[model samples]
Target: MFLTLVLVVGVILVWFLVIGGVCSWVWSRLIACSSSWASPYECGFIASSPKFDSFSFTYLSLLVFFVVFDLEISLLLNLPERVVGFSSFYYYFLFLVVLSLGFLSEFFWGYVRWGY
Candidate 1:
């Protein structure tokens, strides 16, 4: 009990020295050469021209489909290790049915098509 108490007190002391009390004092005493650290451009003038126009929803949608299908493929890959009983098999089948339905609906809706 005494050792645990001493260790707890030491931890509390170290915690305060690390952050609880001395950290604010140290930051308050430090100084920066320039105050532009908070600005978007600290070392140079900010550019007025816009150059971020290459993004497209087509690529975003494709990326989303890739992620969803990749996740489903991973879950399918881990089938043997995860399925331990009838309940697990039932849930797995239910999951497969749900994903297949979603995929079929997407196919019928023209979302999943050639070149896409």
Candidate 2:
């Protein structure tokens, strides 16, 4: 118990130190700079007006689709180790079903559009 407590305290201390250092660095960079710091040259773009006219739903849809597909790939890759004690045939069947569902959803949603 003592060892575990020491380890946990060590971890907490390390994380606290890291966060404190980062906060100090950011504070110094943002506060102790000249007038040029407020300008757009420091990775900050100044605009006279709003940049976006209207939000496009397609971008959000594409982002959601990407996240879904990425998560599916991660889950699929980790399945073998997770289901090692289960029947292999069941695993393959479930994989096929998931893949088919993804393909059908993409096709039905017009996500597979072809253009020049």
Candidate 3:
């Protein structure tokens, strides 16, 4: 047991030493100092700054609808081969009811509009 433990520790130590040595050598030889460069790259053109727009209500609603339907589909796909109980029917009915409610709510709230 002692021999095995020493062997494992020695192997791990050597592994770490090799990895650290390689990483340090690569860093020293290949990496350029950011201060020596004008930009992130050698290009002269300044790239446009990234646009950071907040998600609109329509986009948020669509995202929520996608997630809800995706979850429902995944659950349905894993259903038992033979559903033989009132519980499954009850759950499925409830799910459909919830989906219908969501659809109606989105329609009434103008989240389903595509005339933008």
Among the numbered candidates, top TM-score falls to: 3
Which residue pairs in candidate 3 have backbone atoms (N, alpha carbon, C) closer than 3 angstroms, thus clashing? none
TM-scores for all candidates?
0.49, 0.49, 0.57
- List clashing residue pairs in candidate 2: none
The 10-residue segment with the lowest total lDDT in model 1: 31-40
RMSD of each: 6.0, 5.6, 5.5
TM-score ranking from best to worst?
3, 2, 1
- All candidates' lDDT scores? 0.77, 0.75, 0.79
Total clashing pairs in model 2: 0
Model 3 lDDT-worst window of ten: 38-47
lDDT of 2 by residue, 2-110 (tens): 9999999999999999999999999888886677667665765565645776667667767777887786687668666774666665765687698779878877888
TM-score of 1: 0.49
lDDT of 3 by residue, 1-116 (tens): 99999999999999999999999998866656545464734655444755546878878877988898998888778566546867786787789899889899878987698686
Candidate 3 accuracy as TM-score: 0.57
Cα lDDT tens digits, model 1, 1-116, are 99999999999989978885676776655634446555656646475756566777778768988998898888878788874667677877898899889889988998776674
Off by over 4 Å in 2: 1-31, 40-49, 82-92, 95-99, 108-116
Q: Give the Å error, residue 24, model 3.
A: 8.9
Q: By how many angstroms RMSD does model 2 differ from the true structure?
A: 5.6
